[model samples]
Target: MADVWAKISAVLPGSVDQFPLQFSDTVESSVVEILKRCRQQLYSDSTGTNQTLYPQIVVDFSWEKLNTGTWRHIDKEWRRVYSYGCLFKAAALCHNSPSAEELLQAVRTCDMGLLMGAAILDDILQVIVRILQGEVRKSTKEDADESERTEVKRIKIQCPHAPAIKEELSVPRIKCPSLESFNTNYLLPLKPVILEGIIDHWPALSQRPWSIEYLRSVAGCRTVPVEVGSRYTDEEWSQTLLTFSEFIDRHILNKEDGVKGVGYLAQHQLFDQIPELKEDIRLPDYCCLGEGEEDDITVNAWFGPLGTVSPLHQDPQQNFLAQVVGSKYVRLYSPEDTDKLYPHQSQLLHNTSQVEVENPDTERFPEFSKAPYLECVLRPGEVLFIPVQHWHYIRSLELSFSVSFWWS
Candidate 1:
């Protein structure tokens, strides 16, 4: 029994510790619980039938058989390894059965030739940890990434998790329409519209080598907060503070692989951080048509490499998402489809839905299929109007830079 317990104790701790996300409890006993349920079903039955039902689980599993005809010890500790597949499935059939918990006690207290049990104990615990537990935690690393890493800490994630993006549609557009017509046709109706040839006059567009090199020259020394991840919804995502020059060096200049996992300078008040850079661009005239003061119109920067995503969500105020550096694909859905979008119930995330706009899960969020949406490939010198309460999704198609204004 000591050898069996020692083997079980050794592997269980390592498996729990190696799991990626922070677990509710480090010592997971789901497999042990499942095994107990399976045992009860086998022994306790109103009908005297010896038939036992088990779940059919498929896995690519293989392991060494211990204490056989020609067994050799791999190490000095004489640890025995036993591997089996569909073992968890048989146990998982007890997911919510009324079986009393006794297998764990039996396994823990079993002294049935400790040496023989030792051979199988370690592998059994490992299989439970690496196979069974791994199955349940496999999905939605993106969910963990978006809500906790980049989002405001006040937000909380609830069940029926956010939907993923699954469609791409075209958004409507106009070329420098009069402010009266713009308000009459789109703003008042709370609709999304794209404005063309809007930022053609900005000096930033004409700067010599206005690529990564020029950006480094201007705000290189400025310290700013950047979102470091391939997408905002990546599990490994987080926020970091870096000098603008250092950011360009580590995330841009030094980048060799691609734009999959790179740091992004986004939704930041770069205009306020480095006022000198603010001289390069001008705010659209459309903002003046609204009731807010010019000072009240908040301008924020969204800059990152290709593949960066701001998952499907809604904002509180009217927005003019102006593209200055590279192109971005913007998707817009009307507030009327709010129910289909599965907006978060929390007040902090209430303005945003849980659904991802790029790879949506129709089975989980079937109503999302019924929602109508508009999308566009926004290029330099163009601005996208996102009316207040409108849900939208944004993704960079290349290394991109843009400014957004939030106004009521």
Candidate 2:
């Protein structure tokens, strides 16, 4: 065992490479012969399923057997080493250069017990030396909400109890509006309007969590960044990188927790992150009318649960907010209301209003009541055009996912 350990410790790293667990080395004959010998020695159970600790041992980490290898709500053993490693790898991938020492140094302290526990570890990682690196993309527990799975049509949220007249502030809704027509009326005027039929052709419209089963299969292993806060206004509000699967399991599936905050996949360039999902959407033809290059147009994703809010804020570029799944309540104030909306005193928040649009404090933010704004409950397959510098507040009314295209 000592000799084997010594031999195992001596090989090159990333010959195994990173997630989806790279194995370009396996194609080489010498590597093949070596792995063939490993198979012979580690035989009798290509699956390490035979080595069960009696009573199917559990751990304080809340690691329990859900089926075979999965446990519910356990912290993914993220350590300082992984932070360094991930930073290194992401930088390397960006620059088109990968370093082996950089990868090995990252996992230098990771214990093998975690690796040995993963059932698929031995079967795949047995070039003789198996190092278990867990980048668990989490489970998208689709079974949790049957209501989200059902197809619903034409659900729009109304802003509750406002004295504001609807006519001056009402947003227009149009069907199949062309680039020329949209440019003539809405785009040129910088007016917010909802366009239907733009997103009906998207492949993501038919995907999991929407088509939860297929999403579970393809996106289960993919890592994503998610926002976890009761609301951004809360002191405890923060962001974390998580698996698409775990995001579904905890935030989406385990929704019995009272609505204080939600797991929001907000403002992530998910189409660029999850290319498999990029096929599910297309950029609006009207975006081509922008000053930026078509490829330079920024496409962002917003996936969240009920009551998730963006507060009252503005972005620097023109926005096409496209709804893919569920509904969102959106309110917009033109840049003309900049002073009336009370821009935050801080430079970072200068573009955001101090007033909560849903429940404004007339005494504290007295001027907010006078800010003229357009309001709409954005429904599925609707795209809301938000011109740059427009102060917008967004709240997801259900488990929702949306795409926004931003261009100069």
Candidate 3:
């Protein structure tokens, strides 16, 4: 064992460490070869079943070198790594287990355990490596042209029109005989008009304790930058905050730099924290689900108030924005008003203007001069539906708490 360890150490970099409990190099190599043979067999006879195992093990051998951070490392180069961890256990079970069913069950259990362990280890290693790399990079960089750098800071635009009248629109007082009648008569008929108390009947609203606790837990959770298809850890979950003040103090208020991007406030995976939301929110559903794919659900928590106005962008899904607490001003344009809005060709639903509504960049977004939209205030318990492809700019009126549900 000592001789084998010495040989591996001599061949590989000092950084290339493996756990002691893991398979030895010789056994690992043998397992990998067996997996490759199984894969080739699977490829030749796709339907063939092995009696010794629950299912036939499939393997494919592909050549890829593992990196050890040094180009001069000849011994580490051209190392053959097999991709069939699952197949290795299956083949092992087929060789040693008494019954075919038992062998198959053992293989399945072993493969699953190995996969989960590998995933957890991979996450830890990635984070550690990233941190180390960042530290090294930070220590090495001092560019001569750093002082020459400049960025085009976005400007805010103010609305030329005065604030629209805030009328207390009467909530529809129709009583339905049944859920069917409510859907057909009231919900269907009022598709054009925004409904005030749609959430009043939702069972989730009544389960306020669960909802509030969940929100607080999310807010208190440690926020990392958004990454694609990454799961939040328990450590991250513990940092989720319940109150707006907590979110701002921990994340937003202390940062001396100005905020950028509407999605920047809440760390990524906020949507994943919501157990009930299986799919993203969309627009057509807001317009009575006329047709189309569902909206991409986007849930972000803003720590500070959103200062600049957002551009007019239309989405395919219906929107159900649940403002937990906090205030926002939403300006909406109708789909029929597309000609005046001057939408960009790259995206059918987005306007050409990137100008903030509070400070329109006339030089770049000249067409925005003609764009007119209706304004509404979205408070807690109220959701504003902009409809599919409707142009809108949403600005935080105060330190706000909101969750938006979109579906087509």
| TM-score of model 1 (CA atoms) | 0.56
Identify the leading candidate in terms of TM-score. Answer: 2
- Which candidate, 1 or 2, has the higher TM-score? 2
Question: Model 3 misses residue 158 by how many Å?
Answer: 22
Model 2, 1-408: lDDT tens digits are: 113323333332333233222233313354334333333322222333322121112121112221235344322332211222232222222122113432232222121222223323332222321221122112123353556444222122433332343665678889988889999998888888888888777776644335444554455544566788846766788877655666766676663456345788775555654456777788988888888898888888887766778889999999999898777878888888798888789986787778878788889988888877788888778899998888899888776788898898
Off by over 4 Å in 3: 1-192, 201-219, 222-250, 253-263, 266-269, 274-309, 344-352, 361-369
| Per-prediction tally of clashes | 16, 9, 31
Per-residue lDDT of model 3, residues 13-73, tens digit only = 2331331113335335654455445434322323334532322222222221223345355
TM value for model 3:
0.43
Sort every candidate by TM-score, greatest first. Answer: 2, 1, 3
RMSD to the hidden true structure, all candidates: 22.5, 12.8, 17.2
Query: What is candidate 1's lDDT per residue for 256-298, written digit by digit as tens?
Result: 3544358888844567535556888888988877888998998
Instruction: Look at candidate 2 and tell me the lDDT of residue 403.
Output: 87
> Candidate 2, overall lDDT?
0.58
Residue runs of model 2 more than 4 Å from their true location after superposition? 1-168, 206-209, 255-260
- In candidate 2, the residue pairs with backbone N, CA or C atoms under 3 Å apart (3 or more residues apart, or in different chains) clash, namely 14-17, 138-245, 139-245, 204-280, 207-211, 208-211, 208-212, 209-212, 230-261
